[model samples]
Target: MRIAAITRDRPPHTKHTAEVVNANTVVSISFFAAFCPVSSRRFPAIGFERHSDEAKNKGNDFVAWNSLISSFASIGNASGAKNAFDAMPGWTIVSWNALLDAYARKGQQLRRMESLLDAMPEWNVVSWTIMLKAFTKEGQIDSAVAVFDSMQERSLISWTIFLQAYAARSGHLAQARNVFERMPQHDAVSCNVMLVAFAQAADPASAKRVFDSMRQWTDVSWISLLAAFARNGNLEGAKNTFDTSPFRNLLLSTAMLQAFAQSGHIDQAQAFFESMPEWDLVAWNTLLTAFAQAGDLYSALPVFRKMPVKDIVSWTSLLRACSRDPAAASIVFHSMPQRDIVAWTSILEIYSQAGELGAARSTFDRMPELDTICWTAMIFACSRSSAGEQALELYALMQMEGWNPNGVTCLNVLAACAHLGLVDRCQGFLGSMILDHGLSPGIEHISCAIDLLGRMGRLEQAEELLRAMPFSPDAAAIRALLSSSRTHRDVDRARRRARSSCSSLATIPLLSNAML
Candidate 1:
């Protein structure tokens, strides 16, 4: 049957012309059916399955098989993509690339990608680029560089990806610039990456230099530069860029609105928002954020009511604005049509900050999903309440639930351990942060550890830690050690710490006098 005839009965909107001229080729039908909007959404995998079966019965059409794999991959059905790959009569380079792309998009499957790359019959630029992206996504920038270096030929995309990998890291802008300079070519994307890097570094001068050097300007080019100025609090620069732009789209207009809102020009922001020819959800949210940041709920509420459609950000922004009044925030929280983790966490933080532990715990319990920040917030609340035992219990429960504690969570956990004088537990948590989570203990963590050691009469170990910690002992760390020395009556150690504190410019003269 002709491909057109097969799809002629499909809805007019779903009908697409196929380029394949052969009447017997199943590949065309497979591509059309797999992507046909109506069938893809309504039947999903079923349509692919039917096409695959027909292709198998008619002949072993690798193109049909590859099409099915790609369709499955696009929807993030890695398992389905793999199944189609396994069923393929013959695998082509495209087949391997399709499967690799599926796994890359699935994320956190680096090991699988490695094994697949090793097993591939050969590597192409596409395959290598996919692997480069997978490493970058996983924050393995060094590995991504190694992959880039190993490639005999690098495409502009590969170079851009390599540039972005460096740019994304704080304090690596020099390296990103080096990569950009060395690139065989520069695209709008690579330039924007540098633009954002400088913007985030609060260097609009450098960002503008890069912007001026661009040979061709895209909308993103304009927005990135405008945003750079906005971020640096140069509202005048942002306005000039907006006014001179060849076109004014919603996104560009929203960026200007954000510049005004962020710079505390609320009056300008409101006026600019009103003047916009049309507004997207983002522009509305930006205005709400302005009032929320300024603590002007009186103004924020009206904007919230005026929005045509409310997204999670819209609700969260308003919820944040009502933070001072937990009762009002709670009312808004309950009224939200949908509550995401951010909203739930915000409400929990409000209650926790208000010293309503019962309400905080209740809100935490009611949350359908909990991310690292949410878990950290609740643990912090318990820690601050001096419920050290309860905080430790929650920390244990957080681990049992398979949530890995981040640095902030570790800080709270260490503080609780210190309050309870659990030296052994404190040491273990510190060690695990390094070994399991791969997090180096910040000075705050070390201070808590020192404090715990001192409270438990391990003054010598506390002193040793103070001297041995990679960070120069801060005021808190020294005070923790000195306080413990006084408690333990280690006069010599106290004097040493006092002198050391003065020399380090973290002087605690009152403590030093008390110690003497």
Candidate 2:
């Protein structure tokens, strides 16, 4: 149960990235069974691998093979793990479990995991639980149920894993709740999973109800409810939830840090960050992002300079801090020891916002590489400078370079077309956005498209487009349609436009006159 040391000296186990205590716990029990009293000094692993060779663990004639097997399994190299396991002169139940963990790391390798389980000389409670977890991971509820029925025995760990699987499957809420109710043993993890499921489904109140009902809570329970409240924009509720936690772990602290930072409580965020006993790169980068997002350059710059480590995130945060000040941003950018695609885009956005097309263009051209966001920034950069033609050129070049345009990029392209009064080109871009890029036309893109249609005296088509939009016509879309209706002075269309604009702006008392 004391797995903290097992995963120590290695990166924390992120469920998405690696297995947790389970792999190492099993390894500790079984793998070391082969060789005891082995020295822990490691030798280099053979072949191309990022991992150092595990501890040579030589015990004279009997070498301990478990550490090597565990290391291979942790990295999800089933082949390497198996090779090590097979080369072993003997096997233990823990060794079999470690192999299963290795195979289960990748959910797609489920069939192989099943086969490996079948080949096990004998099975233990851990072995069966491992198999249950494998099915649970793949979200195969019915198959997991089949295994459960056939299970001669089960543990709380297996029971909890099964309960958690229901939450992972979106439509199985009732089933998940039912499983939670049926549990003879009540544990915080199983309870927290249900709470997190409710939170993700945008039912923070339900999460709260669950939290209140818990006889005893874990750190995860408090953190889940705190995050849920914050995510739902109940900042006051989140703070209250944070206050009630019996203890604070890193995950809880980071969650509170983010909640405070995002809600614009910079001082609270700083206080929380300073209060933490330890910090990770994410924690540092998060604080930097908080200041950058608030445009607190004075605060952000010092933090940037003071950070003991700086990665792409740190650099990008610094650039974002000065995004509104092109010259300052460029100064920070040029002084960077390194520049990646994000760093390029951050400075590009600054120039684009300032409408310094030349500077933005230079930044774009010099980028070592460009992804969709970078290319989109270039198009938006040109859109601001009355250089619709140039923006179109960038859009074309973006496609030529094989970067698929996103919805935001399509919005920029449509804006360029509107500025140039290229109704035909706007139509072409809209077609490409929907048919080629598969982007849904949002309000911004719709507004630009409508304006382009109107400029060509195609008032009827513009009105039709607005009416056909999937979303309700926003103020911009409404305005574009109204502008076109008046330009062509089609009486019927103008009257209809006036009525709709009035309805859309009904709450804004003075805007009715402007719309009419």
Candidate 3:
């Protein structure tokens, strides 16, 4: 048993059991003297029986119960886990934790999770931590925080989990700091969690403060801080973080390369890429994504061609970059080994952006699995290309295909109706937004509607919709109406709306290349 446990990587629990049996005189003798079964091999992984009925009956013995439950939980079968827990005539702390963990992981009902805790009759730090994690996953931040404060005993795990919850909520950096300040003990994991939270919350300075406060650090903490800097577009700061680290891992290197790429320092990014002794798929993807973002699709070509092995992400990145340049994108698309849905979607999006409606339609027809994104892209491209009739036809066909049109698809339909002077069609789309689809119109959706109304010379109705909007109008919508009014010879309405837009918001000067 001891050798098998060791081979199976359960040393801690096995050793603990050994100490208990060895400390007892009679139990140790009886344990060895009993009819002990011997296995043919030291460990069983590849050829192990997969829980046959006979094997399961034999596995009801005390030794295998915990392992069985753990194995089931690890595989993510909450139903099977509950069955195992119920089958056990007696329960242990380990078994309870496994069951509760399965529930938390599967995101079962919170009440169901609480029922498991209540049935325990006695609880420990592990049980509380699981509950905290469940609440955090469900976005019940207040409940998670309340549960933490109410715990008579809290550990490093509890503190780290709570801080993570705060960070997940937008603009809650201050809450994370408050939790970190109150923790009785701060370990590397705890510090690293806070750093990641602040970094992702768009506060690199807070992330840095937590990182600097750590008395000792791990590779995780180092990489977390570096990622924060990278996300904030602080290329020099990210580089400095990497240089200061005592140990650098693959993730840090990738982060630094991506940061440099985003900060428009392509040369620095290339330097880091060249310096790596060993490169993984992630490294290649990072470089490809960087070049794609810079609108430099040609640079990714050499990397794509010379890659030893390519995966979905690698192909997707190349295809995404190609979307910006039709000529280059066509070359990449043709050379693909086997195109996935993402590859086709990328090509469709490119044609949409480039106003190649015919090509987009061709790709859409060729796709074996035309998902919602593919349909939406095809329609969106038609709308963008000013082919209102084609876009409307595609929209109707999408519905006929039993695919529910989402907000993005609706927005495009509105754009098509507005551009084509189909006022009745525009009204029908708006009605669907509220009555059929049950989607609350966002600013972008409202903007499309306003553009539609403005184009029809209904300036008064457009202004009313702007005022009636739940959220404030964006600059683009206001400016579109104002500019359209000027073209329609409604100079007074145009000037008034323009002045209101300028005064109501800090409107940036419209770029000359903007589509409007």
Better of 1 and 2 by TM-score: 2
User: Which 10 residues in a row give candidate 1 its minimum summed lDDT?
Assistant: 1-10
N/CA/C clash count, model 1: 0
Query: C-alpha displacement of 322 in model 1, angstroms?
Result: 2.7
Query: Which has the better lDDT: candidate 1, or candidate 3?
Result: 1
| lDDT assessment of candidate 3 | 0.72
Question: What lDDT is reached at residue 441 by model 2?
Answer: 80
Tell me the TM-score of model 2.
0.70
**All candidates: TM-score:** 0.67, 0.70, 0.68
Q: Give each model's whole-structure lDDT.
A: 0.80, 0.74, 0.72
Q: Write the per-residue lDDT of candidate 1 for residues 244-275, one digit (tens) a residue.
A: 89878998999999999989999999999999
Model 1 — TM-score against the truth?
Answer: 0.67
Evaluate model 1: give its lDDT. Answer: 0.80
* lDDT by residue for model 3 (1-516), tens: 111211121112221221121112322222132112323212333322365343367543533554555545544557777887676656656666667776775674577776676566355566677777778888877677667766766666677788878866777878878888988888777787788786786567888888888899888787788788878877678889989988867777777777788788887788889998778888888888777766676788788777888887787788777766798788878878878888889888998889888888888888889878888999999898888899999988988989888889888888889888887778778888899878877888888878878778788888888899888788878876775676577766765666677664433343221223
Residue 56 of model 3 has an lDDT of 60
Model 2 stretches astray by more than 4 angstroms: 1-68, 75-83, 90-97, 103-187, 190-203, 209-216, 249-251, 267-284, 306-311, 396-403, 504-516
Candidates by TM-score, descending order = 2, 3, 1
